[model samples]
Target: MESDLPIRKIIHVDMDAYYASVAQLDDPSLVGKPIAVGGGGTRGVISAASYEARTFGVRSAMSGALAKKLCPELIFVRTNFERYQELSEKIRAIFFEYTDLVEPLSLDEAYLDVTVNKKGNPSASMIAAEIREKIKARTGLNASAGISINKFIAKVASDINKPNGQKTVAPEDVLPFLETLDIKKFYGVGKVMKEKMYRHGIYTGADLKKKSVAFLQEHFGKSGAYYYDIVRGIHHSQVKPERTRKSLAAERTFSENISSEIFMLERLENIALEVERRLKKSKVAGRTITLKIKYRDFTLQTRSKTLPLYISSKELIMENVKDLLYQDEMRDSVRLLGISMSNLNNENPKKTKDISEKIIDVQLKLDF
Candidate 1:
């Protein structure tokens, strides 16, 4: 049976250790050495790690202390957001030269839909190569890309060849490629989920394919359906041009845990101020204010209150946050505090495609 779904060419371009790479590019002395961007202080968390540092198991989100233990000589560099934003714009400009269907996931990576591009390039793989070359020429940074028929496969393939490399999973190879993929390699399947899938006897995509949708849903809930479809190369998500901002937030991880309400209030004030500044800069207000608390033991808790009217000022945001904070007694010493605003006034409608409408079996012609 033939399906009516369109066979689109999607490319996922991800920079190689964006923050750490930028630091190395700016400083000649740091190249070829173990370097980590961010995670400077006692309680600091790593934002990015260079390939050199990664050799010693140093990774982003690892604590500064632990990273130091992993690689004693690892150089720690502070994050410079302004510099990162500047380079990100340069890369995105190059992406626009080929197609306007660019979706930036972060300052480091984005998804580009070039099924019908301005360059009239028939092969997405060729466009990806050109873009990587242009980025190297313009910014002196290496980028990796994954080209496939859908975003999920494209995203996963991008990591296959890392640090100045690219991979393209032609339409004909999608099913076989996924069948042999390790369950851990599936995008969105993290450590916890991987362990859960292991217990279910799903160690690979082929194992996942054997399970019935009803069995998957009964065990894994909503995400089970997603896993069932994706394992068979059946993702229908489109490459959105404009991803809406669902919420705005700011957070701080304290060097030392605090148990006193007075100290908590002090920390909340700073967080609220940052959130307000961000909200005002974006010209948006929110009716829901959520207080995120992370305890010393790493347990997380959230308290939220939604008002009838939208609020963007620091004073109003702090007012509701204080109420939520006092609404419950301290469970343990707090290690991190965050303020997030949701139900924003600037929410925009998103473009969506229904994967359930039909199954696509067209042979894609993406060449590598």
Candidate 2:
């Protein structure tokens, strides 16, 4: 239940590589080594990788065959989703110790409306720090946190530091930070809107601030108002514990999970471009991008990257995704390709107010 309070404090917490990291932590030898949780042949796809495997280009969603090509020594493991769910529930229980206003996005991420809490902590930052420490100690996993006056800033803050990291965004710094952020990184901005922003000279958040409410409304239609409010750091939406998610997606099964270098790149580029287009239309920014791959042997792998920034650019999206992909050692020929982005932008829409003076010297005759 929400507190009948003037201010609502929200914090976003995300575990780093929840599944893969967990597997690695359970097995110490896997540390500092490239390892995937899935992918063995034409029907298999990677589920996750150790940080070491990430460096070698093995990633979730790449054809097992392709992952093998990138990393010959890549090891594959199966996903124990049930175990992950158990851990997720354990973490959720910990969150409940502080506030009942907890909203889970997935097993690894959640938002906590801590405006009023059972623990009665006055400082959100303090609570965030304590939470991080508690999660680490309890789960043996690193979690990042964002603390702010609102959800958008809080989510963004969480990313500034990652892998057992935390950050706070005060009210005074919110607008400026949004202004300087990339257009694609804004909560409501994406590739197509970005193209429009580019044409309108709105590359950075600063540039976006230059747009007038009327102009933004004209281009973005109803969302322009949303853009307007966020730029000013105002959001009427509450930390909805039961808010219905606007979108849901699933994997695209391929005709064959064969791994051919040229074929995979072409498929990847197409998949990315398509997802990029969809994100633009909704004016949504997602914090997580999950890649799914299926190989010939009917094996599967899933890898995901949660961004500190809500992003909607083909380049930024693809860059992290590509990193996740190339982490695998080529084990067999790949036949499928897939991509998805979530954690949509949570920052307020920005509007740059130009303080530049319009000089009109009506009384200049006094100088004469």
Candidate 3:
């Protein structure tokens, strides 16, 4: 498989502690101190933590109370998303100077294809170094970079040296590099998968590579074949240039699960309003509204309806979602709720029809 595909030069660049670094950059007094960007309350979750805070086991997504317990001196600073967005845009502008094929994973990370760059740079590593330097010079922040033949390896390599460092995996060294990598370090191999692989005596990339494709497929289902190819340094995924968003969504996990319909409706209204705000910000409207619900036991369900016309108003979106919520019987205590709008513009009719028919195949995984 690796032989059949053309070799590509991919670079993964990640801002070091993006939100936390931004906070320190904006305020001189916060430098070199352990700080968290989030609400400092029992119910508040940390959005980011400075590297100093991480030394004490504090992390993003951890409850503020728990983070405070981990690092008593941790200072909580409210998140300024508008400022983060401004910096992210500036970084993207620097990336575009070298290559147009930049795929942003989040406000803090991106994958770039520099096989044929606008600047005619042949070395991806050089391009990555320049990009990181430009980001640091422009925003007063550091970035880490990884360069390799594919997106998967590049992304993994990016973490090898973090917080103002870069790593490059040469094409010739790709196989050996992957062979010794810990299974836990593999992309998409989470805690559950790691335990399952260890039980199967597969703790490293070399161990995973020893299994037959048929055996892997039999054990891991669809994801098994994926593991097999990646173990041999054979990822073929490309960097897709940024495109208009296909959908806009906002979701919230409750601090405590609720069984009351009144409480659920109130949460849905807030989610719908959030979605409406995002749609307006992007200057887009959609004809379809989807309602996603997750129960306490982790089972998930989604309901969607298509409208006769595109709508972006909060009231209209909430009206559709409310209908779907009441149409279904109360299953179990609800732990999370989300609302999303799709079918924006519908400029490509065939693609829209295909997506509509196969949309159920798209699985939504909860990060928390």
Query: Which candidate leads the pack in lDDT?
Result: 1
Sort every candidate by lDDT, greatest first: 1, 3, 2
Model with the higher lDDT, candidate 1 or 3 = 1
Model 3 lowest lDDT segment of ten: 351-360
TM-score of model 2 vs. true structure = 0.62
> What lDDT would each prediction earn against the true structure?
0.91, 0.72, 0.86
lDDT of 2 by residue, 64-152 (tens): 88888889888787777768887898888889898777778888989887666678676777888888888889988888998876677
User: Each model's TM-score?
Assistant: 0.89, 0.62, 0.85
Question: What RMSD does model 3 have?
Answer: 7.4
* Clashing pairs in model 1, backbone N/Cα/C closer than 3 A: none
Q: Write the per-residue lDDT of candidate 3 for residues 1-368, one digit (tens) a residue.
A: 26565567789999999999999999989999999999476667899999999999999889899999989999999889889999999999998898777889989999987776788667788889989989989899999999987889999999999989999998788888998999999989999999999999999999999999998999899998899899888886667663557888998878789899899999999999889998998888999889999998979999999999999999999889889999889799998899999999744533322212222233422110
Off by over 4 Å in 3: 242-244, 252-270, 292-303, 325-337, 346-368
Off by over 4 Å in 1: 1-4, 349-368
